[model samples]
Target: MSRQEFLVDIVIALPSDLPPERRAELVAAESARARELRAAGSIQRIWRRPGQTANVGVWVAESATELHDLISSLPLFPWMSVRVGALARHPLEDDHQ
Candidate 1:
């Protein structure tokens, strides 16, 4: 099946009282997983929001269910507030895959 494009926005809000060591561990794990996804083409692009623990990415998957699974696989999933939106090509734009 062909993949679909999705705009993903994520904000990670860790508990204030959580141990610093555990926070670092979680962040490192999330970074590693994100790298793997990028290498596999699931993450087309990602941009971090300045002054905030947030990011937006262009992602791809065969279906919304699959996309959800992929996002949920992140180590920081439990601490993240995420929003996903499907994307479609604009009529006036050059062909985009």
Candidate 2:
């Protein structure tokens, strides 16, 4: 089967007075989601900056719909605001050359 990929970037608008404990909890929950994705072998890599305003991750899936479903499965989906920068596939070498 051919590998599919998406490039996603998220920017978070953090709430004021967000406590450290709550932040930790949110992170823990997100980590669990990541673990699940890893177990399913769909996630390619995840890059996160806790103290910053954004996190980025790459996902490999069978289709774009699958990627959407995967993102919806994350706990952060409800409250966490995000902006998807780009969602596209890289050109195959044969196709490009």
TM-score for all models, in order of appearance = 0.94, 0.64
Which predicted model would earn the best lDDT? 1
The residue pairs found clashing in candidate 1 are: none
lDDT by residue (30-63, candidate 2, tens digit) is 7798799978877777788788866777778777
Ten residues in a row with the worst lDDT in model 2? Answer: 81-90
The whole-model lDDT of each prediction reads 0.96, 0.73
List model 1 lDDT by residue over 1-97, tens digit each. 9999999999999999999999989989999999999999999999999999999999999999999999999999999999999999897677653
